[model samples]
Target: MNTVDEAPRTRRGGRGSRRELRSAIDTTMLPALKRKLPLVEPMDAAQIEQIDRASMDILEDVGVIFRDPQAIADWKSVGADVRDDDRVHLDRGLVRELIKSIPESFTYHARNPANNLPFGNDYSIFVPMTGAPYLRDLEDRRRGPTLDDLASFHKLSHMLPAIHSSAHHIVEPMDHVVAHRHLRITYSSMKHSDKTFMGMTTSPKNAEDVMDMCAILFGDEFMETHAVVTGNCNGNSPLVWDETMLGALRAFCRRNQPILCSPFVLGGANTPASTAASVAQLNAEALSALAYTQVVRKGCPAIYGHYLSTVSMRSGAPMAGTPEISLMNFMIGQMARYYGVPWRTSNTLGGAKTFDAQAGYESASTMMAVLMAGANYVWHSAGWNEAGMHCSMAKFVVDAEQCAMGYRMAEGVKWGDFNEALAAVRDIGPGGHYLGHPHTQANFQEAFFMPELFDNNSIEQWIADGSQEITERALKHVNRLLASYEEPKLDDAVDEALCDYIARREREIPAVDALNNEH
Candidate 1:
């Protein structure tokens, strides 16, 4: 094991006086831990190969429908069988060859270099929740999320060490106009957090707007050379690709930005009911879209995204953190390894209406599954509730603690010389304690996982302290972080440019109500 001194220091300054002091302290005190892949595969070689062969057959025989004419034409150019009706059949050999060009791993650049995330391999990147319409907390009430709520989530994510990326639309800002809400949410993510972030994928225009904003922050030329942004493209399952998602995919791919080619499938609803069959269909959809990224630009950075879950057949409600989902996460990780591409999945997902026992168990099970599966990009790492319909601030804090625990789990156990621990054990023989031993004193802080919100007080002490529940304690932490948040500084010119772009684009886009009417 490398000494702590060998670990790199993360720079956190350059904004203001307070931030400078905070950054200096953070860099000197806290060293980033390098994560390792120590996962055991759920599927053996034959099972994985079977899934691959089945997926290939689905692509070649059933074929995939590309609703966009350009997509069909692009496939045709590559000698793919593009029927007049927009169904394109891919050659297995061609796909295998094209996918070989994709790099196994790449660095996702962040404005703050210290926050840069490594994709692929053993490294696991955690991102906040995306695309929720409602906000909830310990009060157990749900309401439309506002711009303020969105900013708070961003700040919370920024403050947490476990959350690596401030994902786009952590929650939909319903108060903002639909046509221009992305501008506000993206701006908040950029201004409030210096970490890696995702971009809008609602349409080609939205994607372009996000890129333009990124260019302002990172310079036009830098955007071309570095992947500073990522966007997600969802394939309309049952082997269909909608025009809007395809357009966004093209925009991101053309610029060499990473695109997460995901299939949003709910088993027994959009996909086959059987776990094996659902996985096969999910694999086909994800592979087709991933292959499309290569078709757009060979060697383009892409992630095979799996949003697989089962729906309750009786009530048709989406279920999360199920055994089926865990199996899918493991299977998808194997597939991604086979295809030589990074994969993305979610964590802390729960279908419970509140931050109760049900939510805790469900989220914990799902988080463990993703970590053990060795997911490269983890979204919804925190704050998801009500089956993805709501974002809870309390849950965010709770989940952040869980994520920190996951980091330790991913680090695995150190197998180096244990002389210090052994000596402590010897010194504190039978009927003795090691709490005050020299080695224990030296290593306890680093060896133990300390939770910020979980209560560990004695019963009497707890009563004296008002006996707060986990949710209540989490809210206190949330309030403290929000109160302490200092926006990361940006260059004066870049800040002005970003503001000007948002203003100009807001005027260019139709009003939200008007756009809704048109639709």
Candidate 2:
């Protein structure tokens, strides 16, 4: 709640004596990523406006379906043409006016004040992938994830230098009951990590429970003004905003917490086959959701969001890391900037079932597009595989390491000690190597991002080191991380209060087996 306590990214070490490089595998993840790369804007003003105008048309003429009666009423109250309790046509004037209340940027408060994240304008927060029904375990077994697996991810997310938020429901904890899984999920996130996290939006009650838990963890008075948590609301494609998502949106917006107004688009299936057409619809949907957030509580933070993946025409399956997706990301980024709101995008995603070369290439492509497109909140930044069907344990660690690598690139070129470096070059002869030079010694540790999972050693050295592949090495790092994990600071009374709250909620909610009807 206290802005004064905002933590800056810990400065890189100077002398080699007390130096510590940020490594995802080393479990020293406190300082968060602050992106510095220039945004990639491929579309010009005219092109961007074309999409914008198309989106406005979609909003004004085509209209978006709002399944929630409260949402429909809210729209009608705001001068929208409400044809019925289920559909509303929003005017561009009203949409823009309502959108004006959204701030350009805001702070996402973390339990550990030191880990607080700058949410909107300038920074990008990398988060782990969510909603993985199955997980490829450490022993290479593909199975549904359990509560312990969920806790393992939180621990890894806490320790991974590049991961910013614990990200609620990293994987569906199938071991826990449907009606009550949220309590365990939320508790695990708070217990395993002190970072900022997303709240469960499975049901309105679950959303309220996340807020209540947050109130217990962070004080009730503190939560009144500070945005400590976030929730994601996905719009059904073809311009439909169902009650399942609207309820969660209202719950988070009422508390003044941020929500991702994302449209879940499966191109050519739920949405138009044309990339530009789909984007226009996606944009209109996002704008309507953002506008409604203002209607719920004016000035509440809302992110311009979308989950982009083109459906394969031949196979009818979703594809990731495609050029079309990247192009759409660039266009979407430009659109969000024009609207003066933050945006989110997917990252480190692949269709590969195993953590192989295909996964690496696909993830790399996605990461490049995400950073260049200037996404402020990058979800599914790690461990996403098979187009979100499963989260691999090896891939999770490897993906976190890859995020660390991307973090370095997104930081862009540094020129802090440029003159000294050139002087060092002048001091050494052209033929002479600089490896032993004082300049190299002074800056080598922080000079480059050295990934622990990657093998940069020679063939003989690699063979001598047991010739382990990346997946094998990643699994080893995962085990090492869990073994070395330490619980972050949480007050004793607060912990007890959270425990008491969860125990009581378990008794209050009815027991259910499957995670059906996330309403």
- Which runs of model 2 end up more than 4 angstroms from their true locations? 1-26, 514-519
- What value does the lDDT take at residue 409 in candidate 2? 88
Query: How does candidate 1 fare on TM-score?
Result: 0.92
Residue 289 error, candidate 2, Å: 0.5
10 residues in a row with least lDDT, candidate 1:
2-11
List CA RMSD, all candidates. Answer: 5.9, 6.7
Model 1: per-residue lDDT, tens digit, 1-519? 222222222123234644544543221111133567567587889999999999999999999999998898888888998875799888889888878877788887888887877678777878888888888843546887788888888888888888887888998887777889889888998988888899999988999899889888887777766788889999888899899999999998888889999999888899988888888999989989988899999988889897877999889999988999998888889899999888899899989988999999999999999988888888899998888899988998889889888888788887553876887777788999888888877878887797768889899988878878888777766655554566788778888999999999999997848634532
User: Model 2, 12-105: lDDT tens per residue?
Assistant: 2333312332333355563556778788998889989999899999998988999988888888787889876677888899999999999888
Q: Rate the local accuracy (lDDT) of all candidates.
A: 0.83, 0.86
Question: Model 1, which residues run further than 4 Å from truth?
Answer: 1-37, 137-140, 512-519
Q: By summed lDDT, which 10 consecutive residues of candidate 2 come out lowest? A: 1-10
